[model samples]
Target: MNDTAHALGASRTLWELAERRAALTPDRPVLLQGDRSLSFGELRERAERVAAGLYGMGVRPGTVVAWQLPTRIETALLSFALVRLGAVQSPVIPFYRDHEVGFALRESRAEFFAVPGTWRGFDFAAMARRLGAKGVFEAYDGEGLPDGDPAVLPPPPAEGTSVRWIYWTSGTTSDPKGVLHTDRSLIAGGSCLAHALHLSPDDVGSIAFPYAHIGGPDYTVMLLLYGFPAVMFEQFALPDALEEYRRHGVTVAGGSTAFYSMFLAEQRRRPGGKLIPTLRLLAGGGAPKPPELYHSVVREMGVQLTHGYGMTEVPMITMGSPDDSAENLASTEGRPPEGMEIRIVDGEVRLRGEAVCQGYLDPAQTEEAFDENGFLVTGDLGRLTADGHLVLTGRLKDVIIRKGENISAKEIEDLLHRHPAVQDVAVIGLPDEERGERVCAVAEQAPGTAALTLAAVTAYLRAEGLSVHKLPEQLEVVDALPRNDTLRKVLKYKLRERYSGTVK
Candidate 1:
């Protein structure tokens, strides 16, 4: 649509785009949570009211406001309100407890903290008080969301490059780092995802992950640009939520690799039938997708599974298109958008683009992250193919050095995913005196399947023509891999801690 391009090309700030889209499609559905839907027109009107109320609470331009809320319509409303007022917004994942929450509030020096009073049986207000959070208020249950006349609202933000979003890293390995983002950067990221998917106004999408995640805005901007609707799941669970997916006739569905695995598992329960009849594509990013999983989905689920590469710093870096070759979709993380620049320096993926974040909240960390050429050091070990598709090997720190030889965890994990008995697996390096580090594979067995052993795994890898040294030397089976609350990415650091023997 020409309007979509105009919004992507011309709008400087998110509020401007929201307003422009609202003018174009006032009554079109945008954010849908079950029976409740917020049209573009309502987004502008309600955000203005919320912004006015926040201003009444002394939340002036440049004010820092922090909120820890779940994936819900109210959360989006609060975030857009901050954008409307040009205030810096730091959204914490609802699952983060006081330890991370306190650090974010104190580090950001936030003027206010918003929380759900008693969401998921936890009293966030009590934690806010315990942490001595400033300007604490309940933002849900229709009790205390900022409310006032839209007539009192100030003009919406015009600048897009200013730092307005603060998203924290998952913090699996260390203290979470605060990554700063902007409207233009987020818009650029969202545009890449939208165009790559080739969505239409009649198409319907769904959100299966947390709304506070960076992907939230990335998906929201897609709706605004393309004039489509997406179902928002407050709490996503399989079979239970499958009814909703079918009810909405969702055309595109997926959160990440974990989400794809979850869908595949459900499909396996009842094979030879479409999980959602209307579903045509499964698209997502934020975690690695195994090649076998792609083949299985296309072969069984009867839908295209296009994965991509994205991080909190840059919500969307590259995205797999539906029209790409099966081999390309299975092996690569798609190609970068027109503005994105990807470089592989010593196997570390480096990026420089408008979609990239400004930097971290700490100046020193920011300085350390960017190279002299202003490229953001992604820390991810990867290489660009001849056609420019990114193929990530593993994290630079995640490489296991075994007797002076580096073992890529991703390569092993991808191979292991093909094994029938292995439901999900994580390859971690455990310390050993002789080998320096030993390759270990921890796996979750498929339902009703026999247990997998180290010998069997090694033999399978060997049969598949894997290097002898690259085959896992140790194997451990678990009920489930230790994963973070959001996106359910395997926490290999936790695995290392669990498997780390008493040695250097």
Candidate 2:
């Protein structure tokens, strides 16, 4: 392993690092959204202009700039611009409705906001206007921002200087908590991930995940930090993604496990159509990988599939590296990065690392997140194998205890996803009269496939050696599952709202 300590001893602030990289690789393509392409030099120049514009609007160091924009080159540039001006950025997912957006803006206490006039079939300018009228946010126009010379801007004063980014977690049981990350942490996590994925300047990354999420920001930072080219897609349509991959020769692409499943489905429909020949890695997160989906990608798409495990609190905790065995990729979230530590207490996963977030925006939540020993109690149930691989069971809070028997919803869901007819599944604990709680499986079947019944699914589970108690008591087949932007996470609470009464 390369000595991270020696390599990062002279690390600079986020902006300084980006600027130094831009100077080193001036003519390299930094971002590509559709036909638009910006070289590193061009990207740096645009970021400086945007920084000057923010400065003109009285956005100084430590000012919070809330942005609700789609995945675009402008969003990437403006984010870097905020870092250059020493202002913190809070990027809300573009799909967030008014209530969610209003809450995040109020919670973060942002002074300025940036969004595209319109993007990807949505009118963000209209959304901004509505938010402005309600006094929800102070909006700025990114399209009209002027360009300035990047060399004129001063570097950040010191390393570890605060450059905050507030991202909300998809709270399953409670309101979303704002996870506050520093520039140092973001850069460190992104650097480690870039190395693990073996990304290079020549690699073109297709980013379909929302920029409001951690994966989006991580990819953007990786591209900038390593001088890699990125093709930003506003949405994750499989056809559009395939076209982009072919057009850009994209090598590294990733999002949720569901996205990969959908991509494979599309690939099956279009036989003999291979667009991404240079594609080397397909990274997934936000949920466990279905064994079927993993095999499909390896057999059909001809790419290495990697699963990443982490939350907004401690982003990039574990990842299935590019060099990992296929069995490791299918079973574990690979190993922790060089300087990270992971342990299991009782059944909950805990982590301590430089990449971990400082704390929540709310002190009370922060206090609840960390135990007395200062390790961030991840609230995730996982165990480490003797060889040091991390096997995630499920969320500690989401485990289903039926008559004193603990059942992992993830285990059931993984088995369900392997069923030939099952496209996706989410297992949740529903209230029970006798047992404390029973498992209910909500599934979405593959298109054109016959409808699946609970009995059939149970038969498959039985054949797979699942105990009778572990099988879901009830199954609800649906057209689609509610998912976050990444499509990997199923909003179980939503399922609870709709199907809790159906559990036996």
Give the top-scoring candidate (TM-score): 1
TM-score for each candidate, following the candidate numbering: 0.98, 0.93
TM-score result, candidate 2: 0.93
Worst 10 residues of 1 by lDDT: 1-10
Top candidate when judged by lDDT against the true structure: 1
lDDT of 1 by residue, 34-54 (tens): 778899899888888889899
Cα lDDT, model 1, residue 334: 96
- List runs of model 1 lying over 4 Å from the truth: 1-3, 502-504
Q: Any runs in candidate 2 off by more than 4 Å, and if so which? A: 1-10, 118-142, 146-157, 161-163, 273-275
Model 1: colliding residue pairs: none
What is each predicted model's overall lDDT from 0 to 1? Answer: 0.89, 0.77
What is the RMSD of candidate 1? 1.5
